[model samples]
Target chain A: MSYITGPDVVKYACSCGLLKPISHLYFCRYCFQLRCSFCVCHEVDSNFCGKCSENIPSSEARVKKNRCGNCYVCPSCQQELSTRIASKGPVNPEDSKSTPKKMYYLSCQFCRWSSRDVGIPDQSTVTGGWPERENVHSNRLQELVDMYKAIVLAQKQQKDKDKKKQRGKFLSYTDRTGVTAAALRKRIGLPAEFTHPILKNKPKEPEPASAKTEVDEVPEQLLTEPINLMEITTVEQRLLQPEAQPVTVDKLFPVHKQLSIKRSLRCRHCEHNVSKPEYNPSSVKFKIQLFAYYHIPEIRIVTVEPLRAGKQCELIVKFTNPTQHQTTIAFLKLNMDEEDASLDSEVAEVIQDLDQTLSLQEKQQMSLTSLPLSTSQPSSLISVPSRQPSLTIEPRKISQEVNCDIEVPTSSFILPPRDDAAEYDDSGDTHNIQDDPKLVKWRKSNKAFIKLNVTPMSDLALNSEVVCGFIMQHIYTNTVASKEPQKYNHKVKVFLRLGQLVGSE
Target chain B: MSRNNIKILPGALVCEESKLRGDITIGSGTIVHPSATIIAEAGPIIIGECCLIEEQVKIIHRLPFDQQNKENTTPVLIIGSHNVFEVDCTVESPKIGNNNVFESKCYVGNKVTVSNGCIIGAGCRVTEEQILKENIIIFGSKCQMREGLDRPGLQTLQMETLSKMIPNYHHIKKPNKKV
Candidate 1:
């Protein structure tokens, strides 16, 4: 016999007629139908840490009280204390300085609360924990419990009355049907089929005369109930009692304890011995093992020069990939304030093109040219003039198939001579000789354009070598243009380099 | 109504000197107090009972700017029950919720979410689509909070330090799990 699979299940509308995905739809066990967030009542059952077995509800987790039923705080400083394992021996070799017994330290930095003041034997050890305080007055406890029950019953009665008043105002059609059926049965001298069992047992009663007035004044009905002192006593007693406290051991420590081998290596050439550094390679190894396969691309600004208003400048961005797998750089877009038009248009074009190409490897260098400048300066930029120009690079999209190398050229340019005097000198006789001296200077500067050629690096990791060429051109043309045309040229080369470690094993 | 006969709903707490205009439906256990003005200019202000409207609470369904035109009316202020509106609270837009609390001097702008069991602290201003989670407590004055509580403490200095150590640490810290 062949097994037959049904057609792909179409997510029909919920019982409440809400069209949602199968994932969004939840099976209402009570209603036996699909329910969405809107249809069913969402009641938080418990607030529990998935790792630990500790759980507490929102009402019990009061900020002012600061006492969780399962967690203990140092009474003095209110810092959460953890449980530690300890051996019972005066001179246990395992409990020596080299191998100290595990102890819980409930120390608060704010108030310096320590667990030592709580009279627990060995503050560091979990043995002889804080003594449990028990109430010897059993009779009082029983009386208080009885009083609480009575208060609850009275409160419930008041609530029922208020609900009845509200229900009376509704005037449902079922009530009319019930009345008509009862009257017809009485006229025919037959039993009423629809009459409820509970109602059948009760004698017929006349309707209240002030039913309308009662319904109208439902809100006031709740306030008429008298407060019971017995209920308050139980509530106060519960609030005053110290809550139960539990110990929490860090789970990570147990997993890390198994791999606690401390190994050291020495280099013979330098006659230098390398002990275990503060930054353990094993820890880095563990992180790599955990997240190397699933790493996301991150873009950051390595360095930025002086931000020019309404002028174009180059930005050097450094991209780092900690994962083993290579990441393709699809597009590196920037989000500037909408008001800044200088970089908007030019940067958009450059990013759009870069997005089409560029696939960067793990720990690779990629640099792009022609970064757009922001026309309108940010308020912070204007106030802090000395601050370097910063650009936020957002990798718009990422891919794995396509990759392109980013070439950042580092070079300086010298402006060419700007002279139109020699060519127009032959026609000087026909033209006005008293031309504005400023006008002549203006024409000279306009004719000049800077040229630059970058020297590519053979080894990208060479830090001592100059990777970028910068030139600040000061045009001394005595031009009478409406505004002085001041231009600046700066170039930057972005590449990845291994940072130095003070001490490494 | 007699002073003793004024039924204060389960969660409803009203502050002093508050004036309520027109027919307002407060749900069970709702409280409203002195000096707070809940005005239903165009439509009724239906607040689910059990909501706590703290001292000096001001809920205006219609903007004072819209009063110029007779035809153009304001939206109704529909608040759900079990909400705590703290002292000096001002809600402009109609907000709906249960078990939510707005701390002192909170300014909830137009069209925001004060979701279930959220505690908004004193002097906070919510302007955008701020979706607070259940049992979430925001403490501070004038926070530009955003939607999605999954990324808690993203804009804080602590997160910045982590980002400095490991680039894109937030993306790696927790798996993308949506509640």
Candidate 2:
């Protein structure tokens, strides 16, 4: 089965309340919990252009407004525009030797839109000096932004001043002596100097924006003339060019290509990276990828009998062990009533560890993913403020229904470790092991076909889909470097969507 | 019916490898690259001067099913001058005007009529039964139409260079007419 784009008939309940396919889930080894995209923190790692595949530094991308400098997208069809050259006729007709001058213009081969359509002159150079449009309200927006920034800075300074006043009970030596720098200088027969703090000289306050009472009147032509659908820009097109979203077709200009970003996902509980892509934009590799598909056994439906309502049907499913270690699988009842005590303990441990990591004696404030400490904080502070302990997000309840009952087998089965060379070997079944014929149907290298019996509910309607869920408790051998290979029982809730029920027999 | 029926005017550069069928006439200053095919199934075909038919281009002039049974009378397919059939382009259009460009991998159906200064963009297919107006460009996924400001300029330098270099490596079809 193609898991990448295939319809997900098999899904696993993530640590969060969300239910997702196994391919989308990540297994955090330290915390031993299934993490999904919703449970992880996504952060931008790098920015690059999709057209040229050139990596743009984050700082440079910020300066360029997160757009490629040389590449342009068509304003009409949003396709990448290529530079086309036009050869001009020689200026001096008498001189046959004079070469024709070449001019470049941005043109889209897909939509046949060119810079000349908008009355932009062709440039003499290949990389055309295309004119950039400035936002008409940029000046007013800048003033507003400055005013807000100044207001925030003033509020922060006021808060700091309140904190300093609270700490003023422990007076300084100069205050205790009732002698300032000027008083001490006069007593020592020296020149006087002012003892006022630097904060006494206030910075200039930014002017706030003024709101006008009168609004601009609607144009008269809008009421009389019929609107042309082709000339008017769509909502998506306007959002693409946020600076000057021209309403008319002729006012549309080529936009610089937006840069793409590589994202790194961090596990929310343990703060470990579940998946971290390489910094180089061209490299499609990951530094840390803890996918659940690699750790947990993969289940694929091999064959199933025609399902009928209120009838037991034979279902054969194959399980593949992708890990290097051999594991044992057992069938457990899909019970949603019991809370997983181990999951609760793991979260509590993570919170305690986080508390120890962010001690008030050292780092008073901590950010996620081990972000660097604030650079604006001075090192001379003797006492650190104590903050509240970090709260842990509790594991959500498993919200799923098992309409069908799967007969749990008594005996467990053993799956051999994966061996790459065994695939090429024509010799079959070298390892002789006892297997219950009813439980295990067939066996191969690192793969086994197990038969199951399922009964749909009697009240299921005709042509209604039958879903069956089970708690698969498999023996997981952790191969951490610090400890010996330890085998632990891990339970994963899996749901399988069976075919529609047929007529009652 | 025979290769002897093909006529090449003076200054025309028709490569020997080009596949020509039926009564075909090539005008002066026309360059037909090797592997270009022209089939005049309906009748005689006349190509005008300064036309460039690049390699792998196919020009077919077939009569409609109703008129196929009419004997002793054959319709003529006339392609105007300064038209360029780019590489791998297939044109079954009944008529083509001057300064028209059928870009690379473009396909123009028999029902379509291409007028002056029209450009069928690369990989575009025009199978609809309609006439393209002058300087109209058809491109993009939706086949959006737009008016061109000016006609595409002729590749005189490339034509001059190809005329001098093609005859050295491959056999050339000699001119049968002085005009």
Candidate 3:
């Protein structure tokens, strides 16, 4: 139960050499590998306001600057402000027929701040039409953005012309007939040149922005007057209103609540979604969720005797087969050097082909030189395919240390598949199986506890924690059925933080 | 609206619909609105003058678990003058000083000692055993504490208006003796 919220004492080494708990790892069925958040690609799925739970389309969210249209947060405390009604008594107290008029205003119940306190008038409607402040420099910024876009487009056109010149293969009659036509027109006594219709209608280039020399001077009162910390806005408060960034508290306006986004994870190697959430923000269901906890066998420390330096202690660990098929657990010596040597041998075979594809010169010849694009036409008119992100994650060697030694058992144990009905049935020992009493201590329907001898390192400081690790090799049966239903050995390095060592014997 | 085991001093305006139970004493000039409940489970309670207890406000006097084993003595909850308990607030504080304001929907646990001019903001659950400093205001979702430059002003106008309007709508619990 503590494993859910407490610190992760047991960790599994990911394929990318990062150590993480089982909950943080996702199983990619196509690649048959465990992928962590660092190895997977994240994409925004939807944007919605958490306060009102209203789904805002991505395009509308962009137009609203990723903020909710109707919701607002308090400028002082950032809490959601609720609309409250204030009843104003009748205008004429002497008139018996006059009725009270109600008005609405935004108020932060937590901070006791009312819109009236800030001199904002109450509206006649419940959802008050709050005045929104616009960016003062919006026009200037828009001009700058337009200028940059034009400059970029012009530079792109220039590059296109250069590329066309490099090709120089298009033999248009205009170039060859210019001199011949002039001589022919001279022989006939007529004008040789006629303006092309397309060139006359070309768009005019946009003017560039000019740098300004004058700037605003600092106010002289800032030097003499003592600053009031309460009245002055902090950096965080100013940043909340990115457009205005008011320095005084009086200028602080209610900010629209920022929208939250749901993210979907995709495996980089297979381009398959490892986890994808539903489109609706209110629903917490997932469309695709391939968690490693469901695919791999889970190991837990059941109990361990008091650990003393240089003394062997009995450590009992339970293994549960989460899959529908039975699995055999084998304990191997935690030898990373041997694994690295095997990986090097495999890499030696593929390095030649990898080197050929990794060369920049070869890539350039294959991409640009052979396939020449028609430069006479507008490049924007041609819709080129978007570039796909290539998988570039390289596997790294495991970097970890083990201070305690675990006595490897000679025999391996088998765990039965998990059965939901087994929980209710009182009848036990339905399946007759032979087990080694030395290695297997206790057995349940889907779980089994195995005993091992562990010894902490001697000559160590007192009260130091004992850490140990092992290479767990389990027989995995692939149920994907893409190929033959075959059994394979899947190995993962498991590290555990054992209890602290007592005084040396 | 239990009349037994309750005392309302002269000039105290307590609505007839207000629920009063156990040993409780209302001071002079204090106003307790309808639906306000005052329950003294551990011992008697003594409220000072000019305090305003709003609708649905609950004032409970219950001893803490740690203090239950002490020598058997009747503990007293003393609330100072001019304190305001806003709507739907529950205050179990054993000691409260003058000019303290417990905002709407806020909860003060049995271990908190609220001093003068302290404002417990709305929806704040201050269960941690500690003493609140004078002129301190706790607000926000994070329960941030800020020192106010001055004490909050008394709701004199609202109290006066309520005093004038409430007598016309409901019955008032009269003081048993004249001062």
List of clashing residue pairs for candidate 2:
A110-B140
Worst 10 residues of 1 chain B by lDDT: B146-155
Worst 10 residues of 2 chain A by lDDT: A368-377
Q: Deviation in angstroms for A24 in model 1?
A: 62
lDDT of 2 by residue, A15-41 (tens): 775778889899887556778998888
CAPRI class assigned to model 3 = acceptable
The reply for model 3, stretches above 4 Å from the true place, is A1-5, A86-102, A109-114, A169-235, A246-249, A340-392, A421-433, A459-465, A482-487, A499-502, B1-77, B80-136, B140-142, B146-179
Give the TM-score of each candidate: 0.22, 0.67, 0.66
Taking the tens digit of each residue's C-alpha lDDT, what string does model 2 give over B10-110? 99999999999989999999999999999987778899999999999999997656667988766788999989999999998888899998889999998
Candidate 1, residue A352: Cα displacement in angstroms equals 85
CA lDDT scores, all candidates in order: 0.38, 0.80, 0.78
On TM-score, the leading prediction is 2
Which wins on DockQ, candidate 1 or candidate 3?
3
Candidate 2 ranges with C-alpha deviation above 4 Å: A1-4, A89-99, A164-232, A340-391, A421-433, A503-505, B1-179
**How accurate locally is residue A172 in candidate 2, as Cα lDDT from 0 to 100?**
64
For candidate 1, write residues A1-505 as lDDT tens digits. 1121122121223333343333344432111223344443333333433222344444544431323333454332223445544444444666555554455544333222234433344545343344544446555656666666666666666678778877775775646777576677777889766655334433333333354543454566359887532122222223333242212111001000011222332221111222222233223232111111112222233333332222223344333332232222222211212232322233222122323233342002111111212232343434332222233222122111111122222332122232345356664323222323321221121121112222223333222322232211121221112133211111111122112111111
- lDDT over C-alpha atoms for residue A384 of model 3: 33
Residue B145, model 2, lDDT: 64
| DockQ of each candidate, alpha-carbon based | 0.01, 0.31, 0.24
Sort by TM-score, best first: 2, 3, 1
